[model samples]
Each structure stands twice: as structure tokens, then as C-alpha cells.
Target: MFDKVLVANRGEIAVRVIRACKDLGIGTVAVYSEADKHGGHVRFADEAYNVGPARAADSYLDHEAIIETAKQAGADAIHPGYGFLAENAEFAGKVESTDGVVWVGPSSDAMEQLGEKTKARAVMSDADVPIVPGTDPIEEPDAVRTFAEEHGYPIAIKAEGGGGGRGMKIVREESEIEEQLESAKREGEAYFDNDSVYLERYIENPRHIEVQVIADEHGNVRHLGERDCSLQRRHQKVIEEGPSSALSEGLREEILEAARRGVDAAGYYNAGTVEFLVEEDPDRAPGERLDDDTDFYFLEVNTRIQVEHTVTEEITGIDIVKWQLRVAAGDEIGFAQSDVAFDGHAMEFRINAENAAEDFAPATGGTLETYDPPGGIGVRMDDALRQGDDLVTDYDSMVAKLIVHGSDREECLARSRRALAEYDIEGIPTIIPFHRLMLTDGPFVDGTHHTKYLDEDLDTERIEEAQAKWGTDGEAAASGGDGTTTQELTIEVDGKRFDVKLENPGLPTNGAGQQAAGGGGAGGGTTSASGGSGGDQAATLEGQQVTAEMQGTILEVNVEEGDEVASGDVICVLEAMKMENDVVAPSGGTVTHVAVSSGDSVDMGDTLLALE
Candidate 1:
């Protein structure tokens, strides 16, 4: 066992690793950015260190800083929790060479070979795993067109070094091939730093199934069963389950064996996932069981712990993370392949802080006034934040994960409904209503919802109906934060110093709340303010107030003052949580004023421009 492990990540995943370390009686070190000086993970760890700024590039992803921090903290190993630098082969290599610090994951060589898409496909092919027909590293647009002509339209352009659906683009028609190809290349470079892309025959409807595998340096390789992660939004998984309801017993066995064989063939060690795209039979109905002849092909390999790994753990009773650390420490595989056990049906719902009705857009600014999660025999809440902690808008929107287990999928669904109803949160919108509705929705209950179910079939009106019953937006806005902590900072104004109490929203004034001055703290970017009652028009003055749709940094402003733009013309682009969103003109007119610049941070509903 490691004497100390530095967690090179943040939020729920960081908390997850820290808890694992504690269970092993291992010391843990947590790293945080300026924005997360007092983050939940930091609070839970044995010790914490400041990395850099709030931006991930400068903080969690700073490879050098993380390695240095591990040495300083006297950590014998470093655990790169999922996301951030977890899958970066270069980081893994650096840790491997860092004198005494061991990397608690797969070898960098294995990661580089298996983490890249094209390379993984080749290795899987050599291992006799069924692979999707695709071209090699595609460089020109002609390659995409040629592949599409051979494979038919609706080809998928995927980044060679991408996973979790980040650097992928789909071309549905011949006319869109060129444009989508360029867009795919751009995203591939921007997200993965690799513009090399490949084309494959895109399956119309598929269920995403993955097998969890762990191997030891002693040559023992085994699989921990499989997980069904079919429910998704814009390629991001929202819900996941174990022992796919769609897979036949025989097919399941084949898939599991294939995953184990594929990883073993690549000489991969430590924790990894072998993902497969199970193509739905074209003639099969929604609720029909898959036939013995149903086709399943290898998708890719995720060389790190997954967000939905809880589902696998609940069913298999396996401590995957513990196994990861043990394997890295030269520990032998605890159990043989046949000794692996899986019991009961389990499901994991990603409790994200986003509005489902509003296209799953993240909350701009809000404090967690209430964060009461559910509890019981078969429920587990994995999270980092506690009540009154402000939501971190600079990263992923997932606030936590709620996993439920039961005797079967039926009981699991029932338990999910009860747990979701009991899961209380305030001050920020979440997709809880969406998860609640999935329990009752016939397609989901029957385990028939495909990856495109949410985006393609689930009606927005139905989602709105569910939100009305379970959503907290209406009530949360009324409820405020609980006064708990306090901070004081000094700011210079006209060479005069004044002690001002910057109140957190929904908390009581610290004697002089209204007179609180902001912008003196680390995360002091924006604040909501209102004009005096008598100074501005009494109730409201109506012009045209163009506002931001979500909280983000202004990446580029397309329109300047007095510039004309038609309705739907993109006026600016926003970079939020590593995603680029276009803020466009709502109505055709001249820009009266540009309230923000390229480098300004903004909150949702803050005016970006005004038009008359």
C-alpha cells in the first residue's frame, strides 16, 4: 500500500479517491485551484495544496505542478482520478520517471497504444475482437467522402486521441461531409491536441456497453462484468446501469470475454474499460429482446476510472479503485476470472446542476442552500460539496452521482424513484426531474431507451411536465443560502480603505450587508446589482436587453457598437467548461452597446449587449 497518494483532480472524483485512500489507511494529499481553496475535496483530504488559478489548464492539468506537489507532500504514488490528466499518457510517463513517485494507473506505453482510437482499433483487431469498419488516420476531406461512399452516408468522424464523445462529428448527408469534417478536425485539435481523425460506418441506433477490466503486472487479467451506459445527451452519458437489459446471456459472455482478451492482448495493466457499440437490429421493436445474432463491435478503450463506475461496484462488490492502486503497487489480482461475482441490478444517475428543460445548459451562479441527498439500504451518494457551498461553474456540471441497487431492474427503477424524490437540492437547477421521469417512462422502464432516446424521442413537453412536479427551480430561487462561513479581504479605492462585508447570496447580512463591497476576492468576477428605486425608471424601462444564456468567458465578440446583425447571427462566442457556445442575435438590429469584451467573465442573464 502507498504511504501517501496525491489526488491530482478535484470535485466528486477527487473525493472518491480520497475516501478510497482512507479506507486503505493511506495518507491523502489534495490539490486545488484558487477558486477551490476551500473546496469539498480539499476539506476531506489529510492535507491540501494550492495549484494555480481556476482555469483547469493552469491548475488540475498542470502536470509539472502536480508531480512536484506529490514529492513535496511525501506521496509515494499519485492517483490521477478520472478526467483532467487521468488519461494523459505523457503525465503517466512523467510520473513513472519521477524517481520514487509511482503512477497509480496503466503504464504510459499501454495508455498511448490503447487510449488513441485508431491505435486501439488496430490492437483490438489483432486480438480478434470485432471492430467497426473504418479508415486509417484520415488527413484530407477526400478520405471522409471516400469512406462514406463505401460505407454509405452518415459516417462518424472521430478524433484519434479522443474519448467520452468530445472530439466527434457526424455527417448525415453528402453536402455536410466537408463542413462536418473540418469541424471534426478543429474539435479534435482543440480538445485532444490531435487533429488526426478517422471515419467509420455510423450505426443508426446503438446501446453503449462497456466491460470493466483490471490486470496486474504479474500477468493476471480478469473482467469485473459489464455496464450499460446508453442514456446520453450530446454524447455525454447521463445514466448508466449494469448487466445491460438488452444483452442476451450468450452475447454478454462473448462481450465480456472479448473485453478481457482485448486488454490482455495489448498487455494492459491496471484499471481500464473496453467500450462496445451494440448495434440494434433494424427490424427489432423497442422492447424486443436482442436475438442471438445481434451484432456488437468494439468502440474504444477508456484507460481510466469512469464516472459511472459506481454501478459496476454495486453489482460486483469489487473495489475497482482499490484494485487499481494495488495492481500499481505490484499486488497480485485478488480473484480469478471465474471468481468474480456480480449480484443484483444497479443504476447510476448523474445528478448534474443543469436544467433539462433548458437543453441541459449549466447553472450560471448559485449557492447550494440545501443539498440533502437520499440514503437507505441500496442507495449511495458520491459527492464533494456540502450544503451552502457555492456551485463551481468553471468545470463539469455534475454535482454528484446517485446510485441505487435492487433485486432486479424493476426493483431498481422503483428504488430510483423513491431515492430521487427524497434527494433534496436547492439554489441550482438539476436534471433530477429528468431522472425521475425515466423511472415512469415506459421506454426507459422497459430498458429500451437507446443512446439517442433523450435527444431524439423523449419529448421536451414531457420533460417539462416532469420538471413541474419534481424540479426545485421555483422553490430554490425563493430559498437562500445558510450563513455559515465568513471571509474578509482588503481592497483599495481612491487610496481609501473601507471594511466591507461581501455577503454570499441568501445569507444574512453581517451587520452591513447592503454596504458589502465585492471584487476583492479570488473568484470576484461578477455580481448582481440593481439601480436605486428613484434613480432609474420606477418599475422597469423596456428597451432590448441582450443577456448571456449561461455563465462563461467571452471568447470572441463578433459584433461591435452600432454593428448590424440579422436575427440568429452569432454575436459572440462563449467558452464554458471547455465547451464553446455561440451567443447569437435574437432579433435583427444594430448593436447599441457591447457590455462585454473577449476576456470578460459573465453570469447568466447578465447583459452582453443592448439593442433598440
Candidate 2:
């Protein structure tokens, strides 16, 4: 194994790689942008170096800066952890040619072959792997229409270089095809720098299943089974698990074989994922299915460690990062297909700092407090953040991954529930509530979920109902429980805006919306904080006076003496934990007093602007 390795990424994944390297007695070097100088991963590394600014383009994606850092630290190799430059073929080549510094990933030539979706599909086709039916490059809208007719309606127009659902549009009607196709092309060019596009028959109600493949220099290729990444929103995976619940034993074998073949054909080595869209239509004939009743078809290949690789690692005792390092050092295959044995089931929930009720909109805030991850036999929490850390909008929204393992799928689900309940966070919005709901959900529990699980199986009505109840009133806030309020309220003080939220209430409430009917009490009312009719109380704050919801510096005071304001009116703005929240008026009433001003810092329960 290499003596030293540099992790060319940030966030939880960087921390994950560092831990793996340390376990193998390898000194680890960490490269961080200015934003991550004080991050957890930086402090965890044996040595750390500053790369550039927070913006990914100026730092993580800056290949030259990363290479120089590795060279300066005298790193023997660099591990591009998943995102930034993980899949950049040129970056891999640059590292490989630089004397002793190796790239701990697949060969550059392999990446080049699989990087281009159109080319990879052709390669998979030639290898006898079943691929989705679509044209190589459909430049015109008429071609899309023609393909749609042949493949039937609801086909997808995808950019040649698109992955992660970017630069792709689903067209369910002929009239919507032309505009969406052009839009996809534009997004493709803007994001991936490739305007080229293709077409595929959309497999409705398909599960996002992927097989993990590892190949060594000796041409020994093996698979680490499949991960069911069906839970997603906007094409991004939210939850993932190893040993898919949908695949039969025979189908699993077939998909695993296909992934091995694809990797072999591309000369792939190191860590990579072969993604497929598994159709859920049980009524389809075997002839209609892609591979003799196997409904799964090739989607694309991810030529790097996946965000959900922890689940795979949990199920299989083998450490993927260690294997990547060994392979880069010219080692032979560490384990054969038969040598690898999977035990138990594992699941991972991606805890993003985003609100699930509002289309999963990403939110930003600084950590007011932090808690150590819960420890148990089968629970693992991976995070690269710490107390006083800033959650910026400059990168991906995911803050941590909560992974749970157990003897079987049912046990894993139960453990996931216990883990989510124990995991605690504050000062920002998270999807923990959604995950809690999913753990007990019928489709999820029954293993009938699909890629559109978030869209199809989710109880949006209930989620909305809960958001409406808690979003406005202090008593109904999402994090308000145990007589401790942990909800952030946006208020306008003077003319500026402020953002704030609750933190570490001990016994935190996972965002499960509101409690079931007859849950709260006879005295409690689920009234909208914003002006609305229906709840028993005109406003939930009738007995409880409205106050500053979180710790923040007051930006402005919008109310004056005897100034009557309606509910939801911009009352004041507090800049709390680095976010601007607008404090709205709880009811139509005259402003009794204004207690704070711009630049004045205050804690939760401090009266900034009060309505009488």
C-alpha cells in the first residue's frame, strides 16, 4: 500500500476516505478550499493543505491546484472522492504521468470509454449487455418524435454527457417534446459542456438499481452486488440500500453478470457503478422484457466511488477505498468473486439541508451546536461537519449520511428508524422526518418501492398538512416538542430580512410533520402561522407571545408604536447562524414595541418586535 495518499475532495466522503486510509496505517493528506479550512475532514487528516476558494470551480475542480497540493505533501497517490474531479479523465491522466503520484481510481482510458453515455451504450450492447432502446444522437425534434412513435409515448431526451438527471427531459406528449428537447440541449451544454443529445424509451415506474464492480490490473473483474437507489427527488438519490428488494435471485445474478461484462469490456478497474433502470411492470411478457424477463436495462455508468457506497461497504466487509489504493499500487485482485461474501442488509439516508415540503429546496445556515454521531452495533453516521461550521450554498446540500445495518431487510428498516430517532441536528432544515416516515411506509417496508418512490409512494398530502401546521405557529413548528421550540421563523425587521431556526432540543423530533389525529391535545390548535381560518385559535401565539425564534443579530425593525400588522407581515429580520429569516406578524394587531435594531445580536425568546 502507498505510504501517503491525498483525498481530492471535501465533505463527508473526504472524511470517509481519510478514516479508511488511517485504518490501513497510511498517512492521509487532505485538500480543502477556503470554505472547508475548519471543516471536520480537515482536522481529521494527518496533514492538510489549502487549495483555493470555496467555489468548486476555483478549488475542488481546480486540477492544477489539487495536483500541486499532492506533490507538495509528497503524496504517493490521490483519491478523488466521488464528486469534484472524481470522473475527470484528464485529471487522472495528469496524476498518472506525474512520476510517483498515482490516481486511485479506474484507468483514464476506461473513464474515457464510459464517460460518454452514447459510446458506453454501444460498448455495453457489443458486450451483450441489455441496453435501453434509443438513437445515438437525435439532433432534431422530428427524430425524437419518430423515436417516440417507435418506442411509444413517454420517452426521454437526454444529453450525451448528462448524468444525475441533468440535461435530461421526459416527454409524455408530442407537443411537449420540441421545447423540452431544446431545453435539455441547452442545460447539457451549460452543465456538461456537451450539447450532443440522445433519446431513450422512458421506463415508467422503474427502480434505480446499480451494481458495484471492482477490477484489478490482472484482468480479474468482480461485482459487489446491487444497491437499490430508488428513493430520489429530481433524479438525485436520497436513500439507498444494498441487496435490492426488487431483484429475484436469478435476476440479481443476471444484472451482476451484465455489470461485470460491461466493466471488462471497458477495461474498468478500481471503483465504479453500472446503473440500470429496472422496470416494475410485472405483467410484461418475457419477450418484451430486455433480457428474457429481466426488466432492467442499462442507464449509464458512474466511473467513480458513488455517494451511496457506504451501504455497499456495510454489507460486504471489504473496504472499497482500500482496494482502490491497492489497485492503484499495481496490486493483484485482493478478493475473487467467490472470496467476497455479503452478510446482512444495510441502508443509507442522505441527510441534506433542504426542506422536503417545499420541493426539497436547499437551505443554508451555520451550525449553532453539534452532537456526536450515535453509536451502536449496526449504526454508522458519516459527517464532515462540526460545531460552528457554516453550511454554505456553494456546494452540494447533503450534510451527512446515516447508515444502518442489520441481519435482514426488516431488521435494517427497524434499525434505521431507531437511528433516525437518535440522530440529532439543529440550525438548519433537514429531511430526517421524511426518512422516518419512509422507514415505516407500506411500499418501502414491503419492498415495492421504485425510482419514483418519492413522487409516487410519498404521502405529499400528509407532508403538506404537517408543514402547514408547524411552519407558522411556534407551537406547531416542525422542531417544537418537549416544551422546547426549534423552528426558524423568517421575519422582516425594519426593512431587512433575517433567518433563524431551533437547535439541540435533546429528544429531537424527526420531521414527521404533525402527530397523528388526537395527537397534540384538546388545548393545542394546528393553526397556520400565516393568516388562515380553521384552527381553534385565531393564532397559536395568543397565549404565547411571539418572540425572536432563534439566536441572531437583528437586521431591522419594521414595526412602530401602534402600527397594526396582519399575520405573515414582515415584522423584522434577524440574521441568525448566517441565515436571514423574516419574522412575520402572528396576528392582525398593533405593534406594542420594537425591542431590537440592526446589528443587535439576541438569543431565542428575546423579543425583537411584539404585536398586541
Q: Model 1: what TM-score? A: 0.85
Q: 1-612 in candidate 2: lDDT tens per residue?
A: 899999998889999999989988999999888877887888899999998986567788898899888889999999999977898888999988898898999888888789888999999999999998988887888998889778898988888877888778889999998878876876566556688999988888887889998889889998999999988776888889988877677788889999999889888888899999887864533323224376779989999999888898999987888888888888898677998798999999998776667666566444524454566989988898876677754566788899899999889988888887776665566777677667767777777766786876677976655444334321234444454435556888999998765453433343342333434432344333332331222234333245655545565567786787887888876654333468887778877656677656555455555456
Worst 10 residues of 2 by lDDT: 530-539
lDDT by residue (tens digit), candidate 1, 270-343: 99999999987646565567876778999999999999889999998998899988998899997888888889
Query: Model 1, which residues run further than 4 Å from truth?
Result: 282-288, 473-564, 575-580, 586-612
lDDT for model 1: 0.83
Cα-based lDDT at residue 176, candidate 2: 98
Go through the candidates in order and give each one's C-alpha lDDT: 0.83, 0.77
Q: Which candidate should be chosen as best, given lDDT against the real structure?
A: 1
